[model samples]
Target: MRTAYSVETVRGAERELMGRLPEGALMQRAAAGLAVACGELLGRVYGSRVVLLVGSGDNGGDALYAGARLARRGAGVVAVLLSPERAHQGGLAALRAAGGRVSDDALRDIGRADLVVDGIVGIGGRGGLRPEAAQLARAAWESARVVAVDLPSGVDADSGEVHGDAVRADATVTFGAYKPGLLIDPARERAGALRLVDIGLTLPEDAEMEALQHADVADLLPRPVPESDKYRRGVVGVVAGSARYPGAAVLAVAGALRGGAGAVRYVGPAAEAVLAHFPETLVHPGPPDKAGRVQAWVIGPGIGEEADALEEVLAAEVPVLVDADGLRFLSPQRTRERTAETLLTPHAGEAAALLGRGREEVEAARLASVRELAAQYGATVLLKGSTTLVAEADGPVRVNPTGTSWLATAGSGDVLSGVTGSLLAAGLPARDAGSVGAYLHGLAARRAAGPAGAPILASEVAAHLDAAWRDVTD
Candidate 1:
């Protein structure tokens, strides 16, 4: 797991480690790692022209020290001090000793630099870059491949919120643990490729937010056994679609077929439509209670305003996935009363409805909104949009890394609901089901799009599920 701790946690860890090590040791370690990274980017340290955007904190100290290291190795380095007086005194002295110069030349020699190091701010920064820093960052971005110290300056270290003016780095070299801002958007979007440098700081136990790695994903995947029969794998009951929108039912069933579920039981008025598209599906035009036994249930999707259908699914004892129309009819009281594992998959609009907030509000702060929804409803919440976020009722939030903008098409969410429902039926926990399902769904959409860039249909996405699963499993 790739863990992301808050900015406060990182500072606490830094303080703890700083107390144990000799004075300036931690800063040296940070500078050494940063220098090595700069060297790698430069290809050859000798004769390379490097510019450092110096700010008024330890971040500037890191850049100045690293610049000194590069200067000693024959590189020509210059530091642009935004705040000359407040700049790290020790670092400035070291750089000067190593032949690094501070220049007041504005755009004259900046565009000619080979690399630019952004040391404007670190985790301690709250808002966007100060006026002077922002101007320097803009110039650096236009000229060189910018590398950030700690994080891209001006991005909220805790929330990933980009305030006022921020530096968009080509790559961010972070110290200690990954910040939540590095993994989430809009700060995440500004942060290009992220590189974490271990500074020998031990994080706290409360640091729980994380991103799933390939190995962790592999371990959570469900596999079939030789002795396992169809029933043994698990049965999924899908209550989706209506006379008005039967296509959702077909798409939902299609997604469930690839979920490693033993059997899929469809209970809705759109059975004929579902059977027409997927003959393998066992459809029933009866209520959810009459759909026979099932390990898990998928509700909503294209379901119309039918209180009867919603109530029947709610009464079930198995794990339930509520999506689309189900989200429309959801009440705080009903959600609070849910006994079994409940997973709520809501797009920005639906999430807005559930939270009684505007869609823009939900999208702007997706991490907080998802976590709030989970806590409010006492269920696993998956808020889908540009960057999908899944949050459990009591655990750290997860951000999906494998998604494309093309997934904004209609009916895509329906397939996800079914796929996650099938995973739940197959015995994966709610959090795992939501995150893994999102990863698989995004990969499948990418594959289905292929080289021609064809518009991916819901069924095409479902068809590519096996290939997506293989790519992850292998």
Candidate 2:
């Protein structure tokens, strides 16, 4: 798993590490890593034009020291000190000694530079950049491939929130540990490709957010034993679709069949369409109460305002997953009374409705929104977007790293709901089910989208779930 720490934790770790090292040891380590990354980006460091946007803190010192290293290697390096008087004196002396010079024409020099290093406003910076800094950032962006020091300037390091102008880098080379902003969206969008340089700092066991890697997913995945029969593997009951949109039932069944369920019992008005597509599905009419026994239930996905199905599934003694139109009928009082596990899947718009907030608010503050929804509804909540986040009332939030922009198609959520519900039925806890389901769903989407990543249909994504499952297990 790739873990992300908060700003406070990173600062605390840095301080603790610094206390045990020599005065300049930590900075030297950081500068060494920074210089190596810059050299790799430039390919040929000798004779290459490198511009450093030097600010007033240790971040600026890092850039200056790295510039000195590059200059000694025969690269023509220039540092545009945003704060001349406050620039690291030791770093400035070292740079001058190595043939690096401070420049006043930052824009002109930046325009022609092969690589630009952004060390302006470190991880502590908030809101937008100053006018001069913003102008320099823009110029660097237009001129060359910009690399951010710790994080892209002007973005909230903790919340991943960008209020106004922020430096958008081609790549970000973060040190020690990953920041929360580098994983979450909005700010994550500004951070292009992320590369972490280990300077050897010990972080806490618990991170603010965690993204599941392929190995992590492999461990969490459930496999059947030889003694396990169809009933022992667990059965998932799907309550979805209506006469209006029968395809929703077919799509939901498609996801459930490959979701590690022993069998899928589908109960709804679209029995005909589901049976036609997936003949193995055991179909029933009307409410979920008369659908016979099922280990878990997945409700709503084109069921319109079907309050009856929602109530029946909630009344069940097993885990239940509510999605799409079902989220509308879900109330705090109704969910709070349930003894069984409940998982709510909502997109930004649906999540906003549940929280009684605007869509923009939920999308902007996804971490907070997911946590609040999990707390308010007293259930596991999955917020779907560019980054799929799964949060429960108590555990650390799981961020999915395997998504593509092509996953924004319609009927995708229905497929996800079915897959997660099946996992829940297979005896995984709500949190694990949600996390594993999202990880597999994203991997399946990426695979289905192919190498070029052309637009793919929702059915294509569902069809590739078997390949995605094998990819993880193998």
Report clash pairs, candidate 1: none
Which candidate leads the pack in lDDT?
Answer: 2
lDDT, candidate 2, 321-382, per-residue tens: 99999999999888878999999999999999999999999888888899999999999999
Per-candidate local distance difference test: 0.88, 0.90
lDDT of 2: 0.90
- TM per candidate: 0.95, 0.98
lDDT of 1 by residue, 95-170 (tens): 9999999977956557889999989887888877778778888998999888999899998887777768999888
Window of ten residues with lowest summed lDDT in model 2: 284-293
Candidate 1 deviation (Cα RMSD): 1.9
Candidate that scores best on TM-score: 2
